[model samples]
Target: MEGIEQNPVMYDLMSEMAFQHSPVDVKAWIDLYSRRRYGRFVQPMQDAWNILYHTIYNCTDGAYDKNRDVIVSFPDVDPNSISTLQTVLNDVHEQYGKRYLRRAILEEPNDSYDKPHLWYSTSEVIHALKLFLESGNQLSDSSTYRYDLIDLTRQALAKYANELFLDAIEAYKLDDLHAVAHLSEKFLGLVEDLDMLLGCHDGFLLGPWIESAKELAQDEDQERQFEWNARTQITMWFDNTELEASLLRDYGNKYWSGLLRDYYGPRAAIYFKYLTESLEEGKGFDLKAWRREWIKLTNSWQSSRNVFPVKSTGNALNVSQWLFEKYLQDLGSHDH
Candidate 1:
C-alpha cells in the first residue's frame, strides 16, 4: 500500500513545510483565499496535505510500529491477506480527508481557521482503527460500528453547533446582547439533540447502576466496592477506558432548553456584562482567566446528568438529519 510519502505532491509539500517551521505551516498551506500554484486542484491538494499531517501524527509517539509490515491494505482487496495497521489508518485518513474535510472546506469556506481543525483527532482515528482490528478486519453490521457512527455523529453535531456559535460571535461583534443570548441558547439545542440520540438519561444507565450500588452499599465494608462497581459500569458505557470516557464526558451533552436558558445563557450574559463593565472601568478583561472559567462552566454542564426522560426519537441518522434541518431553519431566521 502506498503511504503519503509515496505520493510525490504530498511528499514535496510536507518536506518543504517541515523544513520551514517546527510544527509546519499548516494554516498558511490550507488558506483557501490565497492563490495556489496548483490552481483548481488546490482544494484536493490541501486535503491531501491535512491527511498526511494527521496520518503522521497518529503514527508518531510510538503509536505506530515502523518496522511492521502493512497489516491492512489500502483497498483491503483480499480477505485472506493482512496489511500493517498504519496502512489501514493511512487509507482511512485519505478517504476521510477527501470526503469529510474537503466537503467541509467547500461548504464553510472560512480561511480564518485551519483546515486540519475540521479533521478528527489522532486518538479518534486510533479508536476507529482499534475497532476495525478487533472485528478481524471484517466490517461490523451493527449500526453503531458502521461508517464510524459515533465519530461521524460527533462531527455532524459539531458542524451544526459551530454554525450557531458563529452566529453568536457575529452578534457579539455587533454588541447585541439579546441576539447573542438567543443564538447561544439555540447553539446548545444541538447538544440536546445529541443527548436524545444517545439516550443519555439518568434512567438509561445511572439509575440502574445506582440501584445496584445501593444494594451493595448495605454492608459498611462494601462502600468502596460499590464505588468501584459504579465507576466500572459507567466507564463500560463509554469506551471501556478512562481516557475515552473522559473524552466523551468532556464532549457529550445532557442539555435542554431550560438548562440552556437558565445556565448557559446567564453565563454568557454575565461574561458579556462584566466585559462591558470592565471596559467602562478602563480595566481590560483577563482573557486567559475568562477562557478557563468558560471551560470550567461548560464542563460542569457536561458533567450534569439528565434525569429527565429521553426525548430524541428515531435512529441515529434520522435524528441527525432532523437536528441539522432544524439548525438550518434556525440559522435562516437568525440571518434575517
Candidate 2:
C-alpha cells in the first residue's frame, strides 16, 4: 500500500508474498520476478536487492514507518527527556499541559528515543549502495534501474540525516550552539538536496498533487482550498488545535520534493531556532511556544498560492550519481 510501485525491490518481494498466501511455487515465482523487474536481472542487481530486502524490507514489527527517521521524530529539548519506554516510577510529570506529551520519560540510562530510529546498521546500507552503483554505469539510461537507484540512495541519505541529528544533540548537550547551528543547516541542506533529487522524478514531485486538487475545484477560491486540503493531509495531517497535538502529525510524512523543502525542512529550522536560543541563553527550551509558532508557519504554507515545478529539472541518474559522490563516495573509497 505504501510505495510498492515506486519501490521496485519491495514490489517484487510483496508480489511473491501474495502468492505464498495461496500456497504456490514461491521460490520459482520469486526467481522469475528477479528477471521480470529489470528485464534481465544480473547477479549484481540480485545482490543489491538481497541487501535491500534484509535491511529495509525485513521489518516484522508491523507499523508504517516503524523505524522512523530522526527528522520526523519528536526533537526533545533534552535528548534524555523522552524515551521509547516512557513509564513513571511514581507520579508522571506532564508537559505541554498533557496536550502533546502526557508523560514521556527515560529513567536511568536512556537507550532509545520517542521513536525507533534504526533497526539496521547504516554502514550496511552504504555497502548496498556500493553494490548497487557497480551495476549503474552498465545499466545507465535504464529508467527503471535509475529510479530504483534513487530509492536506494534516498534510504541511505535519510539515515545520514539521523546521524546529523545525533551530532546536533551532542553539541546541544555540550553547550556548543555553533556546532548545533552548523549541523542544523547541514541537516536542512540534505533535506533540500533530497527535495531536488526527488524532484527529478515526477512520481515524487509535489506539483501534480496540488494541480490534481485544483482540478477538482469549480472556482479559484475553491481551488486554493482544495490545494490546502491536499497539502495539509501530508503536512499537518490535522489543522485543528486539538488534533495538532495528535501523535500522527508526521505519520504521513514523505520525502516528496516540495514537501521536504517547504514543510519538513522549514519545520526543523524552526525547531532548531528555539533549541539554539535556549542553549545560548542557558535556559530550558519552550516546547509550547515552539509548537504555537510552528503551527502558524504550517497554516501559512497550507493556504499560500505558491507554484511547484510540475516537470522534473534534473536526470535521476545524474543527480543520484552526484549525491553518491557528495555523500557515499568516502565509504566507497575506504572499502577499496
Candidate 3:
C-alpha cells in the first residue's frame, strides 16, 4: 500500500480512474498489485471483462422458488439486465483493447495509455517517450524497452485476435458466420493498425491469409486454404488446443504458414457471405475439414508469430509471401 502511494504520478491517476469506473472497487485491488500502465494489465482486464460478460450472458436472478428449491435459472434473469451488463463489459473491453491497439499501430515510443479523450492512445505514448527523451535517459539502452513494449502489445493483441477469431469460427458452425465475420473484422482491423507490431518485413504471412479469405468469399476458389471453415476452426481449436502438435506432424510447420498466407484475407470476406446466407436461408456448410485445416495453419502461424526477435519476421513472411498483397487488398477494401 505504501509502495502504491509512493508510485509515480500516472499510477495515482490510473488507480483513481480504476476505482471510479470499476463495479465494486475490484479494479483497485487489481491495480494495487498491478503495473497499470504496462501490457500485463491487458490480459487481466481481458479476463475480468470476459468473466463479467459471460456471466451476464448466461445468468439470471429470480425470487427463491420454494417449490422448485432454486432461486433462478438463465430463464429467470431479465433479458434487459443481461443485455445491459453485456453492453457495459463490451464497451469497456472495446475501449481498453482499442487503446492498446492504437499504441502498437502508431509505433508509439513508450507504451502508456494516458489519454481517455482521444479514442486512440499512441500519441499519448509517443508523448511519454518524448518526455523521457527530454529527461535525458540513455537512448540506446532504454530504446529496447520501447521495442519490448511494442512486442508486448503485439503479443497481447495476438492473444486476443487468436481467441476471438477462434470463437468466430465456432460461431460460424452454428450458421453464425455473421458473428465470425464481426470478430474477423475486429481482428483484421487490429492487425492492420498494428501491422508494425508483427515485425515482419514483407508482412507476407498476413497478406495471404487475408487474400484467401476474400477469394473464398468470391467463390473464386472453393479449395482456397483460407476458406471460412478451414481458417476459423484452426483459430478456434487447433491453434488454441493440443491438436496443434498432431497437425504439425502431418503437414509440418510450413503448411500452416502457407494456409495463413493464403486465407487471412479471403476468410474475412467469406465470413460475411456466410453470415448473409445464414440470415436469409438459414443454411451454411458443415465446415469440418475447413476447421481441421485451419487448426493446422494457425498452429504453425502462431508459433512463428510468437517467436519474438529470436525469429526473423522476414524469414517467417518468406515462408508464405505469395499471398501477401492479396490479403492486404482484401483487408484494405473491407471496413473494420
Candidate 4:
C-alpha cells in the first residue's frame, strides 16, 4: 500500500467486533455513535450524521475517500485539464448528462486522482453542516462536538470553493478577465480563512511535524535534512523528470495554517497571477515558468525553518462557526 488512513469513529466498531462482544448491529451502532461521539446527543446532530451517512460517507472508492480540492488539482480551463492537455484539443464533450474528457490510450498525467471532481451533492453537505451547527450552543463544552463542527465546516467551505473554481474556469472560457480574477481571488482568500480556522486545532498545525523530524536527527545538518524531508513530503513530494509529472506533490496536502499561508495559498496565487497576465497580454500561459517558480517556492520553504504553533491556538468551535456563516451566509436557516 502507498499509504494508510482510518476514521477515528472506527475504534468503537472495532471494539464491538472483538471476541468478547456479541454480534454487532452496524446500523444501531452508527446511531449510537453520534451519542457516544459527543457528550450528549441532539437530534440535529444525529440528523447531520444521517445526512453524512448518505452523502460523503457513502463513498466506495478505495483509492481516496475525499474529493481533491482545486488548489491541488492541475489547473484547467475545463473541469478536466488532464484530458484536455493530453488530447491537445478541446475534447470536452457532454456525455451521460455530465462533462467528460476524452483521454488518449495513455493518460498524460500519470499521477492523477481517479475520482471525479465532485462525487456527491455539495448542497447536501451544506445541509448537513446546518444541522451540525443547530445544536452548537447547547453542546458548546463538548470537545468532540467542537472538532466535528470544525471538520464539517471545513468540508462545506471546501465544496463551496470547488464551485467557485468551476465558475472561475467558466469565466476564463468566456474571456471575462474581471470575473475570473474576482472569483479566483475570493476563493483563494477562502483558503487563507480556512488556515485560520484550521489553526485553532492542533491536528491541523505544521509545527509538531517538523519538530518530530528534528528529534530523529543526531546533528544540526541531519536535523535540517530531516526537516527538509518532512516538508518536501507534504509539498513538492519528489523530483520529476522531463517526461514524468511530480507524482506525489500535494498528495499529502494539509489545511495547516502555516502551510496554507506560506505554501499552497501563495502557490495558487502565483498560478492565477500568471493565468490572468497571460490573458491580458494575449499570450498562451507559460506552464514551464509556472512549474519552475512553484518548485522554487517549494524548495525554499523546505530549507527554511519557519515557526508553527504546536498547540491548538483558539476556540475552534467559535472560529469555525463564524467562518461557516461568513462564507455561507446565504444559507438562511437550518429548518431543513
Give the TM-score of each candidate.
0.36, 0.80, 0.29, 0.81
lDDT of 1 by residue, 173-262 (tens): 456667766765565455555555444223222344434554667685675556444433322223322112223221222222233333
| lDDT (tens digit, per residue) of candidate 4 on 1-336 | 023222456665676677645677666667888888887878998878876776676666564535367654434232225332222334766632645454333344653324234455566678778777778888868877777777778777876776676576556666789997998899889988888887876766778888889999999999999988999887766676443347676677765668877787888887778768777987777677777777777778878988777887888777877887788867533211
> How many clashing pairs per prediction, in order?
6, 0, 26, 0
Stronger candidate by lDDT (1 vs 2): 2
Backbone clash pairs in model 2 (N, Cα, C under 3 Å; residues 3+ apart or in different chains), count: 0
lDDT of 4 at 66: 59
**Comparison by TM-score, 1 against 2, better one:** 2
Clashing pairs in 2: none
Where does candidate 4 stray beyond 4 Å? 1-6, 19-23, 61-67, 72-117, 241-245, 331-336
Candidate 2 residue lDDT tens string, 17-37: 765657655345545554576
Winner by TM-score: 4
Worst 10 residues of 1 by lDDT: 68-77
- By lDDT, highest first, what's the ranking? 4, 2, 1, 3
Ranked by TM-score, top first: 4, 2, 1, 3
**Model 1 collision count:** 6
CA shift of 255, model 4, Å: 2.3
